[model samples]
Target chain A: MTGVLTVVGLGPGDARWLTPAASEALASATDLVGYGPYVDRVPGTPGQGRHSSDNRVEVDRARFALDLAARGARVAVVSGGDPGVFAMAAAVFEAVENGDPAWRNLDIRVEPGITAMLAAAARVGAPLGGDFCVMSLSDNLKPWEVVEARLRAAVAADFVVALYNPISSARPWQLGAAFKIVSEIRAPDTPVILARAVGRPDERIRTEPLSQVEAASADMSTIVIIGASTTRLIGRAEGEAPYVYTPRFYGVRP
Target chain B: MTGVLTVVGLGPGDARWLTPAASEALASATDLVGYGPYVDRVPGTPGQGRHSSDNRVEVDRARFALDLAARGARVAVVSGGDPGVFAMAAAVFEAVENGDPAWRNLDIRVEPGITAMLAAAARVGAPLGGDFCVMSLSDNLKPWEVVEARLRAAVAADFVVALYNPISSARPWQLGAAFKIVSEIRAPDTPVILARAVGRPDERIRTEPLSQVEAASADMSTIVIIGASTTRLIGRAEGEAPYVYTPRFYGVRP
Candidate 1:
């Protein structure tokens, strides 16, 4: 039996945001695997074997998806936003390398989906249009040294930075530290945008200076941090949320 | 009459890609204004006023939208991708600044949409997940000196870069010039991605080295350029497409 694995991206929460291509791939799968919340967000028949777990079990989940594929099941590994942006696609590929040789023959492909960074960019204006980078401030998986080095590089490069997993319950001050590191390299006047709970109800987006982003309001579920390059502020009134965007250096201010 | 203007984003050409929020905004408009091709993409509506023109006529369209709003008509100024990304939203505001003071009282808002860059990023892998920057190679509006300076800065800063509008029919070699500038500051081994006509039926995505990319086929409709920092060739296969990515620095490659 031929087994195949497809990774699908479920866009920022709303069922309406789900692309038809993504939905069809999920509906055709014989088995589904993913982190718990993401798996739950998938709407469809539950008869397919479902494997879900907390975020901590990535390796285990990867193993499950590969194991199912090895056993001739068409598996769908789902992720919120796009699967490749700090998501599960890499884990599955890594598992293929570490698993039994029999799994090597199985086909695997990654399908694209709308990512939160893209969603957040849309929610605000084109902050990511020109030069921008996406980084996660969460220290749970990597050391601060690595994150700090990247942030410093991002600042010097004048690349707009989109921060992910900014502040969680246990990592309250991680975002502050990242900001400080960025502030050291970039000007205090650099615009910082905080997008809270993107794609979900109660979504909040605001842009301020790198020096003034108070962490008291940021939580783990939020994505935050600064914009660089051509980003600028325009005078927009209340009820008309202002979105900050960097014009393409081409002199086009789209 | 309370004239209102809502700037809507039409994500990358496909009708299915249109967000519900953007669709609803367009549906409610009494006057629709945008570049001719973008205006034509929407379904025809009876009794709705339409304003369309060539690229050079954007400022004219902005004036039209503002004028309609001043007359108390609900207007939706549509832009391809996000209006804020080198689009018409800023032009509208700039027009308001230069126009009669009476129009200042009308409400104006910018509704976000998916950008071409994000869509292109998703088509590939995580080449943009880390610190990245975006730049346009168009010199018609800006001098080559400024573009070269930013390229040097981005290279020194170790940024993954996304290049937009790298070539046009009249300016066929602008991308080659950008490649030469960045190559001076970056290693020849650095990866470069060319995403052409993204999200459209003829979309083409290819990854190569900065040294070899000038020979790569491209057009004015293309987006091109290099990836720096942690960008690496994930895998290369004969007769198969190459894959490039910026490792999720937050964790060990699982």
Candidate 2:
């Protein structure tokens, strides 16, 4: 039996957002592997094996998946959003680059899905309508200085910024620190969108000015979008959430 | 009769990549409006009005969709990729913000899809697995100087940059000029990915060193990805595409 390894994204919380290509890959998979939450998202198959591991052990999990595929097991490595964006695709490639030479010859492919930022941006209006930058706020793999530098540069370039992994139980102060940095370069009234559990039943999207937003609002499930100076909010009649969007035109306000 | 407007993405080329949410919106739409090629992508439905227009008339198309929706038509304005990224979601919101006040009261939603960058990145390996910036190189909406500045800043920040609308028939010199700017800052052996007509039957993906990529290689359908300094390529046995990926670790090689 020739083994094939496919990494697929499940999109945000909604099953409707899952692509047909990903669904097909899951249905044909002989083995499913991912973090416990993501693996649990897949419906159990009759003979398919499920390997769920802790979130922090990406490298170990990747090696295990690669090993299974090497032994002629058809494997599907899953992530919550698009595998290319801070997900299992990179980890799998890292394992292939460093693991046994035979791993490179295994049939590996990445199936893209609707990433969290795109889903969150859709739930709110299109705040990422123009040029944008995506960065992870967690200082686990990189230093805080790098994050701060990217934030400052993105602000200077007037790019709408999406900050992933904004806060966690282990590190709570990073979001506050990031806000302080953005508040320095951007206008106080710049729109900030905090989207939590996007596409889920309990999804919540809130938009406020930079000065008014509290750092405590974000958790691990949250994605923080800081709008550019060109981003604007259109008010509704009464008791309604306003539409927030960045204009396609630059350097001029409608 | 109350009207509703929903903007949805068709994903990149392949129908299988389309999300169920987007498909549902398309099926429920009484009026479908978009650029000609995208409008032609949808299967014809009875009693549904399909309005196809020229490519450059985004604002006009958006207004027409809003007008139809205001008259109690269930409208869906489709774009090639995720509506939030350089697509119709922003254009529709721009129309709402500047057009009739009653349009604000209409139920408008954005259904996200798999954007082109993620699709192109998946066709290769996870080149955008690290921090990244997405920008359009077309100078129609913004100036050429702004594009140059953002490219320089992104390179300086060591970000994997995804360039959309890199080259079009109308303007041919932008890609060459942009490549010159990047070449000045990046290493000679840095990888650049030119993905043209991705997910289509005639799709082509080419990875070459920055020094070897030509300006004429890209067209309107192309998405150019310039990998970060940390990105590396893993070799395959023989006569196979090399796997390109950026390690999760930063400032150190895995």
Best model number under TM-score: 2
Q: Which ten residues in a row have the lowest lDDT in candidate 2 chain B?
A: B245-254
Note the residue pairs that clash in candidate 2.
none
lDDT of 1 by residue, A1-254 (tens): 48988877786776666666677779989988998888888875768878788886776787888888888999999888777667766566556555775655566666665667666666655566554566667666667776677677667656677788887778877777887787787777778777777878888878778778787667766777477755665545556655466654435543
Error of 1 at A3 (Å): 3.8
DockQ of every candidate structure:
0.30, 0.79
**Local error of candidate 1 at B236, Å?**
7.7
CAPRI level of candidate 1: acceptable
**TM-scores of all predicted structures:** 0.84, 0.98
Per-model root-mean-square deviation over C-alphas: 3.7, 1.2
Q: Give the Å shift of residue B16 in candidate 1.
A: 3.6
DockQ score, prediction 2: 0.79
Q: What TM-score would chain B receive for each of the candidates shown? A: 0.91, 0.98
Error of 1 at A76 (Å): 3.0
- Candidate 2 residue lDDT tens string, B1-254: 39989999999999999999899999989999999999999996899999999998898899999999999999999999999999999999999998999999999999998999999999999999999999999888887788888888888888899999998888899999989999998999999999999999999999999999998999999999999998889888789889889887897543
Model 1: how far is B82 from its true place, Å? 3.7
